[model samples]
Target chain A: EAGVAQSPRYKIIEKRQSVAFWCNPISGHATLYWYQQILGQGPKLLIQFQNNGVVDDSQLPKDRFSAERLKGVDSTLKIQPAKLEDSAVYLCASSSTGGGGETQYFGPGTRLLVL
Target chain B: AQSVSQHNHHVILSEAASLELGCNYSYGGTVNLFWYVQYPGQHLQLLLKYFSGDPLVKGIKGFEAEFIKSKFSFNLRKPSVQWSDTAEYFCAVNAFRGNTPLVFGKGTRLSVIA
Candidate 1:
């Protein structure tokens, strides 16, 4: 089976510029997630979508970051006026039911470098 | 809120050496624990998970982790490591009841030299 897929494995943008990352989850998966991994740290969940509806986004910085899963299959994460701190890898993951103990499969991730 | 802690930032060892990586989590209620590994140039993958029953859990690639409820710890271990075992390992946790997002700790990097 194919795993989660993400676009633009690497990206570079200037500070204050806008950038967007795309994710296509595994077929038939019911839950999708976006995470940010800064250097030397584990991936932190930015948002979660269960069939196009948001399940959690409490940690997301609404002032600068936004994400949507249209039609519940593909999702997009956007960052406006990107800050130097935004330089990190953005990962996408998917699971069947997202229930407790369910394993999540991750994508290759998009590495963003904000200058 | 829940949080996870990995005791080691980096570890190096020769091939065939024993391995152990420590992890601790803070959550009063029942929770699920997971260990994920990311090889070089690869995406993150599950090394193993612990939910209930049998504190000892075996996972892919001869990896295993023991869940200690009282201590609130889940440490990954391997009897003998190989060069391919070199990777970044992350520990994560979430509530056992709800559909909660995972809380991960700062990862531990392992280097196995041949």
Candidate 2:
């Protein structure tokens, strides 16, 4: 089975500019996640979706970040008025289900550099 | 808030050397643990996971982790290292309570010399 797929492996933008990243998860997967990975740090969950419904997004910077899953298939993460601190890798991952003990597979991630 | 701690920031070892990386979490309640590895130019993938049952769990690439409930630790290990084992390893934890996102620690970068 194909793994998770992400677009624009790298991106650059100025502070206050807007940026968006796309993700297409493995077929039949029910859980999709967006994470931010700062240099030297592990990926941190920004949002999670289960079949088009948000499962968790407590850590998401609501004032600047937003994400959506379309028809429970594809997902997009957007950051408006991006800040320099937002310069980091954005990774997408998916699992067969949101149930217990399910393993998640990840994508190559989009590395964003905000000036 | 739940948090994870990876004691080692970087580790260097020669091939055939024993390996051990420490991981600890803050939450005391029921929790799930995982170890993920990211090779250069690759995505983060599961190395192993601990849900319940046996505290010792074996994962891909000859990696294993032992969960110590009393210590709130889940440490990764390998009997022997290889050049192929060079990667960034991350330890993550998720609480069993309400919808909680998995929290990860600053990763440990492992470099293995052949």
Top-lDDT structure, candidate number: 1
Per-residue accuracy of model 2 over A3-76 as CA lDDT, tens digit each? 89999899999999999999999999989999999998888999999999999998899999999997999999
For residues A1-115, could you state the per-residue lDDT of candidate 1 as single tens digits? 9999999899999999999999999999999999999999999999999999999999999999999998999999999989999999999999998997889999999999999
TM-score, one value per model: 0.99, 0.96
Chain B TM-score of all predictions, in order?
0.98, 0.96
Error of 1 at A104 (Å): 0.7
CAPRI level of candidate 1: high
- CAPRI grade, predicted model 2: medium
- Steric overlap count per candidate: 0, 0
> Model 1's DockQ?
0.88
